[model samples]
Target: MSITAQLRDSVRLPGGDALVNGFAFESRGDGPRRALLESGHELEVHDLVEVFAGERAPTAVFPLPWPGWGRGVHSVSPDGSFAVFSGQRAVRAVSVGGETLWEYRHGCWGPEIGHAHTGDEQEVCRGLEHGSCRVSDDGRLVWAHVVVEPEDQDWQECWVVLDARDGRELARLPLDSAASGSHHLSHPDGIHMGLCIGMGQDGILLHWARWDGAKLTSWDLNETMDRILTDVHTGLPGFLTVEHYGADLRLHALDGAVLAEEAPEPADDEDPPCWDYGCGFVDADTVIASTVESDEDPDRARHWLLDARTLEIRGAVAYPTGPVDSCVRPLGDGTWLTYDDTSETLNRWIEAAS
Candidate 1:
């Protein structure tokens, strides 16, 4: 079935440099609502209800440790009270009021191994290799991937769960892999969080962990596949992952068994198609994905809808408003987001009613 995109509302970003990937529930006032990644190192909270009503001002803004170039990843708490940044040498949590609530410093992400001393803060801002963090559903725990010092080892990258109320370390697990960067995907059940570590040409590493108040339990993909874990949802029995180079999309069983696979089947005379690294379930039954990077001509970039369980290509998404400028970020509520880099505007979309 062919699906068309209908615009419900949009807002121009304050900095003209951000996008709304997902949302958070406010602890008060029907919850603060939407979230905007205001550049890689900065995060801004806003009310989607207000943005839909034509107000675009951020309700709260947070300044992160590293600049955008460092490519660190972060996570915002569910209550919108604070955010934790996985910086080059630390995981720091900052309040909505722009105050540093806590910071847990660890081994540097710099290339200079065997160096016991860390350089200036400026050096931390410039490091390229990085890690990621995520706040638990209750906002009481933080899971992070960072370089840590061990008694018998020089330094190693590991995933650790921390006390969200303080910076105290709780439990840790060795990663045994080098990271160019990583991110956490909160599971729909809110109990488990998925970690995706991108190691450039060395391939990708995927992990899942849960902190159950008593101990930390975790597992990994065992380097079984060169896949980028894209989306996880309660509605699906498993999760979705696209191949590292956008070759094919796969839906996997919870135990990592492939349930279905979808690959580009271009017309014989057309160019080979490729999917972007981003793809997610727009709703329980529908998956939205894009081919922006595969298009040599930007104007021809396309988005497609798929059967979430089967990975069957429904068809390319038709945007009546014209070509969408950015890849779609599925909201999992039958809607998604796309930004216009040229205009600095973010748009929310839904399927057009027949």
Candidate 2:
């Protein structure tokens, strides 16, 4: 099968040497579509988050207080009023005017013995780098994974929910596995969130949680599949996309039941099996799976559209340009977005009508 995507829009970024290394798009409750752009060196450099809409200049810019790479996660609130930065030792909320609204600190992320200067903050870590965080749907709570050392126990981490208005801890749940770090996926329901913990060779762990205002409940799906979760389709509740040792893809329910699985179909005997970490639902019933170059095809990447309900390959998607990097992101509206690092531009793609 073959799919074709047209270029819906394209926007060139600001800043000469600045490239959009990471970004998050928040469509404010059907209002304007805003984006948070994180740009700088991959690690150890000045960084900034520029909030913009369409092709307009950034409406707001928040210069991060620290100068490290993915050592932490940062995001702009849905309404574009505030920004949150979760770092190795602190989680801080900053107002539009650059005032620190509130901050929550935790254990370090690297070795306890060494310290490095970040130009702004003293960088230190004991174990893994800090993970990611997401603002709740209503923008009233923040779900974050923070490093913690329990009494008489080895250093570890916990998933903590914070009162977004004041940065107060609302609830905390200890994670049992040895995680290099983790990332969070927020659900539309506001009360539900998914946490994916990467544990190096120990494998990946997926934790699904639901907060009922009074308490937090979670289920570890790793006890069942033990695969690295590549993406979560929040638009399709209970649906998750995961990769098995980079060899195959599986669609699973949040409750750990497998919905469907697929492996690459080699075109010939010498074609190496190819799969990518990038996969997500294009809509409730359609998923976009990307593939890297195989031994037989090194110059081109492939994008496969799958039947979300059955995980069957519906067709290969053709973009106006060619295959993007493996990090293609879904726009949740039957469209997807990709960044061209060389050109420093963002491209949006939509499936052409059948």
Candidate 3:
């Protein structure tokens, strides 16, 4: 499908070097809501009250002086009234109008480099070297993966499931023998899995495990790393990885049996890997995958379209404004609600007929 840029708006931020971290399209409000990371490592909330006429201004700029520096919000409540923020050594909630509702911090042996500020002092968790955290859908469970030193100062992977209401550890999962490092993906459907990817003994071994409400179902794929890389997609039944051998790359459906695979023209070069975080289900057979394109060496940048079920090449377009994070969602009148973070604008686009 050919996607053309329809509308674009550039808003002047208060501080220099302002990077947008999180954004939400408010349904009830007049315009969209955006959160930006300022130069001082602070977060600012800008409420675009009027969007139709192109006039935009922040309704309120909430300065979150957590601790080390401000990263941004990971999740926002459905109503847009509450948000969960993670930065440095602090993770807490803030009101929509700029008020610190609650915050949690830790004090451990470390420099005050990447710590979040609570109220007066900074805090860091014990052995949590450099990692991130995320809250569950209901905002009741908090999950974080950290790198810690155990017996010989080697980095071991560990997870902590905590009560969101009081910040108490409820469950812990440590994988010292199963896998080394950590990589995971989770959804609201109770699907949680972790992967350790690297050049291993069995020539790129892919170890994966799923949380099935009661027990964890684990599997392994001993193939060339490129094949696993090319077959990666989130829309399918399990952890899908594209395997690229010399002549072709087959999309492995991971836990699910192979649904479809692609082997494009040999001379055209491999069609690139699937990298979109969210996949828009176009139909039972097709999906709309977001891509970030570039002007110089467009193929090198992370951008392209693919068949949802088959992972085949379906034409690619490079936006004029270079590479940007974008999402395409079905909106009713044959148009999709699209947002571009690099341009700091939101607009609509229609998909071309197949």
Candidate 4:
């Protein structure tokens, strides 16, 4: 598949802020448009034209009272008629043009700042309210993962899922218990929402929850962290691609079933390389991963292509020069969307000749 490049020129903010909370693309005029929100409470809308042309200045800016917490326009309707943002009190829905269409709030702040208390004191959460809102593939329903604190001020962690149309708690899941701390990674498939729950030092867990219009049915993973990574099918029903990684450093299925667990050759210490972030599949048989290598000479990040089914090294290439940040996603075709530190923006590149 071919790819197009885009950049936001003048909207660049100084570094040292938190990582971007979230970003999304929506239809604007004739092509896809993009919006980026910085951790400093600034929002920028990039028209497809300006983005492709790498325009420096944004069309408009909104200074939200987000307290420098996570900010983003998480979901956009399929027809591009509406969008949703993660706000302080509620999930705000806006027209495609960024006008407020509606606001729905289910929970509120307690007496103390950065604290949320439930009606029965059964659950409580601290810090800024962290949650996500994503439109379903059909664009008819929106799923919101609302982060909340446990009321007893214990170490327990929990999140509430709300119905986006009207604020309603569809389901509540215990993310972490007093003895465990958990974090969620959203890997939403068509009708099933898959989340990766890391159980602190204990390891990671994968759960696949089915979202019926009215409620949710979840299945606990019988597998552990070492057997990480799962094959995910996004657009097509039976087309499977691995989208996440867990413990074994090998490939696994969505239910935590071991697909392959062979270990690769150990990385050479003199090679100045170390695995950094996560690994993503390039196809059913291939995976692309990033790493940082530093020794007596210099330290840098690079991308590695490996055989997902064989655990063999396919290729390794020097990452483009710039900051250390990098994100790689493959298109349905053989090409990939590679974002590096160069433009401080995303760019596209075809896989090198093999």
Which model scores highest in lDDT? 1
Q: In lDDT terms, how accurate is model 1?
A: 0.76
**Which order, best to worst by TM-score?**
1, 2, 4, 3
Q: After superposition, how far is residue 155 of candidate 2 from its true place, in Å?
A: 0.9
Q: lDDT-based ranking, best first?
A: 1, 2, 4, 3
The lDDT of each candidate is 0.76, 0.67, 0.42, 0.45
Off by over 4 Å in 4: 1-42, 45-68, 71-73, 97-129, 148-161, 177-189, 197-205, 226-248, 262-265, 270-274, 293-300, 308-311, 318-332, 337-345
Model 3 C-alpha lDDT per residue in residues 1-354, reported as the tens digit of each score: 434443333444333122211222211111233333343433444443243345444444445555553332244443445555654345566666667776655322233456544554544333323333555544565555443456775445455555666656566566443221223334324444434432233233355454433454565554334333321323345334433222233444455355655442222454543433333333333444443321234344433345666768675534555544544542212333445454545554444433
The regions of model 1 sitting more than 4 angstroms off are 14-33, 39-42, 65-70, 113-126
Residue-wise lDDT of candidate 4 within 18-66, one digit each (tens)? 1221233332122233444443545554443464465656555544334
TM values, all candidates = 0.89, 0.84, 0.55, 0.63
The candidate with the higher TM-score, 2 or 4, is 2
For every model in order, what is the number of clashing pairs? 2, 5, 15, 15
Q: List runs of model 3 lying over 4 Å from the truth.
A: 1-73, 79-81, 93-129, 147-155, 175-285, 288-295, 298-303, 318-348
RMSD for each of the candidates: 3.3, 4.4, 7.8, 7.1
- Measured with C-alpha atoms, the lDDT of residue 138 in candidate 2 is 78
